[model samples]
Target chain A: MARQLYELCGTDPARVFSPFCWRSRFALAHKGLDFESIPWRFTETERLAFAKHDKVPVLVDGARVVPDSFAIARYLDEAYPERPSLMHGRAHAYRFIQSWTGTVFHAALIRLIVSDVPPLLDEKARSYFIESRQQRFGMKLAEVTRDREARLPEFRAMLSPLRDAVLAQPFLGGDAPDYADHVVMGAFMWARGTSPLRLLAEDDPVWSWRERLLDAYGGIARATPRAEA
Target chain B: MARQLYELCGTDPARVFSPFCWRSRFALAHKGLDFESIPWRFTETERLAFAKHDKVPVLVDGARVVPDSFAIARYLDEAYPERPSLMHGRAHAYRFIQSWTGTVFHAALIRLIVSDVPPLLDEKARSYFIESRQQRFGMKLAEVTRDREARLPEFRAMLSPLRDAVLAQPFLGGDAPDYADHVVMGAFMWARGTSPLRLLAEDDPVWSWRERLLDAYGGIARATPRAEA
Candidate 1:
């Protein structure tokens, strides 16, 4: 069987937006591997039953199946040892970054861009997204992102760790992109693919770091379809 | 000359409390090196002039002086390459954790424990600490930490990343404690040295992790005198 990655997308198959999927995408690119992108939607749980996981970015590499992004990265490193390493045999060290991204970065980001996402989803996925997200936030999607423009400063202030890290080095992995970079850049990719709002200032060190990552891997991330022009 | 570490303390020489100092102290211990702890008060900037930095954690080896905790960790790794690897020769990969500890962890922690610190300081150090911290907070020390007990939940909430990471593993660096563990454990040491407040619930995963670290290296951290009974 050909190697394949099931990725999350919306109306347009090219618009892959899930942050977790983006991590796997970047990981695959970093490993210099080729895989067909199979666009998966929000309500596609049964479709992933073969992997026994209800998440996108599931990797089907030959007979081996990897279900999570971190697991996918580890699988790639283990399978392709000669290729560039993602976690450098220290997958456990990357957990803190993953935790921070999942809890802090993604929590803050969803509040800023959740309302902007439904328009890009097909009707069935859009309904599922809105209902699930509204229940999660305890309010309507629009209410969750209300005053987001005014909250941008607070959101940006919360990014001090990322800003400080990138200011000291070109990437979170330091001098080059690694799984840590992929984890963080995945969030930015979500914002880019869904929200047209300017999440970062042009002069921000994070902006520069994201630019470098966008240009890395032969501008693969940069060339991905974004909501913004 | 014998290796020496200049660490921040207050009225008692044994009450080494600066978070950064704890990092270097832990780093040194991790490397199995012995150093005399020279307690330096807050007002003693002149004492660190040889290192050309006004930091509490300055390592003076036989012929070299290293200032800054992160730099000291790097120095230890370089000076003793055969010792247990702290950053695993990927010191840059550790920057994000350092940044998080410095900005998010430290910033939130100070607000919770800053007021408790003055009583432990000598008069000159106490005055300097008061003035500097008050100026930084734009309020009196007590006012800065007013209603701190009521704010414990929010303060704990800010530690989600650390909590999540430790929940999944024995330490931030995986099976063994590395520089990342030291960097974060340093902050807890500062709180332990200065505050009687119960920062973590006994059942919290972070509390268990802290207990592990406190007992890790011959109970070095646990043996240190704490403000709490």
Candidate 2:
């Protein structure tokens, strides 16, 4: 399918961001599409800027307000078919990887994140969830993170199948990075960069795969600054 | 975009059975496409009948295998363009609802199913997980279900926004069932049918939405049955 052309839009650089936002950025980078990342703050006043959900990762490309990671990925794929394809020709493999990474892998990863690391969050989200944490779990941020710490052995065990799958492939699919790689690259990047555990891309093939992907994307050094507010 | 024909070749009913599968079924129904639902038992020996992933929701029409819910949805959207559109002119709204129902809503609901309700599982899945449940969660089926029972307050709270959204629209996308509606209907049906939360329909508009879609699909009773194993 030929991709349609749409101007890329996103949050500005000066604002604090979330992993979901980062995923969209990485996808744009992967496709080599230059978009304007308009900075957005998650506050009551920001409703007019975004939508009712009060979330980042809301892509405003012209008249399009593409929300959610998968949709953003789809929009990119359809909008930029001239670029590298995130979806391989084998529809089943591409979709399987997309769903696994986006849905199953993401679920486990997010649970670990919110439960395990609050301090790592930027001031905005951390400050927002502080009271809710104590009220709901009867614990402070440290307690929650520590409790998550205890589950590492179990978490690592869970991630093994994923590790094996990616290790077997050169770039999340067979030879090139597809949408699954992008979905995972964003989350895995956060987990590897921000969290205490950082279980991914450490040894042998998994580590090497991550390194190659990073290398292919200009090694993260050339990232465009978030669009100015 | 027209939905290209794909084959779902298999013979094991329970192996690939899930809410997502039901969603795909309804999509086929919506398109009024004459297709076969091939069930397959995922025993080690029979796994090779399919490709490597050995997963259900494999959409095979002719030589193509479309896996994962999003890809399948997109494929359907493309192949069956003349059919009622999955998204209205509001691409953002369509994308948001699709992701919300398929990813976020599906995540929370599936966790409860895997962690809480094992006995209610079909015989195959139950036997597969019985021995490992203790090592994973320090509890068996009954205890897990009890834990889920305690979380009702949290579930209801988490679902408030979604519930309100559905109540706002006659359908999730407004006035008619779209791809997102099918995505959510599958999950809600599984949860409501199998849990104490079966009364979701009385309180929420989603239940009625599901029934209307099913009614549109010839009320499920007259739907074709899978061939003999």
Candidate 3:
């Protein structure tokens, strides 16, 4: 069986946008592996039951079923040892970077781009996304990102560690993109797919670094459709 | 020639207190290397003219002299490849973690503990410390830290990345503490050495992780004399 990766998408299946799914997408591309994108929508637990996971980023590798972005990254490195390594056999070395990107960076980003997400979902997925997100945020979807532009400064400030690292070297992985870069770039891809907000200044080193990653791996991430800015 | 590390000290030469110095100290211990600590005062840049650098963590290892903490870490791994690896030969993997520690974690810590530092110094060093720090802060040293207790919540929130990582794993480097662990632990050592401020809550996972690191490498970090809490 051909490899398949179930990704979270919206009204347009080509607009796959879950940050976790993007992590796996970049990981696969980085490993020089090919997989078909199986468009999974919001609240699609039944579709992912085969993997015993409710998440969209379920990977069907031949007969093997793998779920979760970090797990998939680990699996790809182990299964294709011949490919370029992601965590380089020291998986723990990348865990803090993953945690920081997920907990801190994404938390700040959602407030800036989340309000734009519902419009891209189908009617059924839109309801699910809005209710679930609003409940988590304890506010209306629109209210959460009403003044997003005003909050951009604080959000950009949170990118200092990333900014400093890229300014010192080419990528977080030093000279090239690695699993650490994939994890963070995944978050940027999320904002790119849904919101048109200017997250980083054009002059910012982070913006330049993102541009470099976008062009990495035969332009895998760069090919993704971006929302109008 | 004996390996000697020039470390910042207050009145008591035994109190090696600079956080950057602690990084090298722990890195050397992790590599099973021994070095004599040469006590350095705040205004003693003249004493380090031979190293061509005005830094507290000047490491004179036999004939090779290393001047920065990050450089010392790389040198230890390169110079002693037979020893336990620090970067595991992927030095870039650790850069973001180090950048986060140096830029975010240390910035928050100084505002909380900068005032406590000067009193630990003798008269000559005390005057220099206060003047330099005040000039940088653009205010009196005491004012920089005044009402710091009220900002404890913000400081702890800044540690979300560290808190999240240690909670999920034993150390940032996974099962065993690595150079990533050493970098952040260096920041904690700074607070412990110069201030009585309770930086970490009793129940924080970071606090427990710090306990583990404090006892690491034959308690080299834990044995350092800390300010009374």
Off by over 4 Å in 1: none
Q: Which tens-of-lDDT digit does each residue in B91-174 have in candidate 2?
A: 222333344454456656655655434444456655655666656767665665555656655655545544544554555545
A1-229, model 1: which lDDT tens digit per residue? Answer: 9999999998999999999999999999999999999999999999999999998889999999999999999999999999999999999999999999999999999999999999999999999999999899999999989899999999999999999999999999878899999999999999999998899999999899999999999999999888963
RMSD of each: 1.1, 10.4, 1.0
* iRMSD computed for candidate 2: 12.4
Q: State residue A114's C-alpha deviation in candidate 3, in Å.
A: 0.8
Q: Is candidate 1 or candidate 3 better by lDDT?
A: 1
lDDT, candidates in the order shown:
0.94, 0.54, 0.91
- Runs in model 2 lying further than 4 Å from the true structure: A1-17, A34-140, A153-185, A190-196, A199-213, A221-229, B1-24, B35-201, B204-209, B216-218, B221-229
**A1-229 in candidate 3: lDDT tens per residue?**
9999999998999998999999999999999989999999988799888888898799999999999998999999999999999889988788899889978999999999999999999999999999999999999988999998899999999999999999999999889889999999999999999999999899999999999999999997889888986
Rank candidates by lDDT, best first. 1, 3, 2
For every candidate, give the share of true A-B contacts it also has. 0.91, 0.00, 0.82
Q: Which docking band does candidate 1 fall into?
A: high
TM-score of each: 0.98, 0.46, 0.98
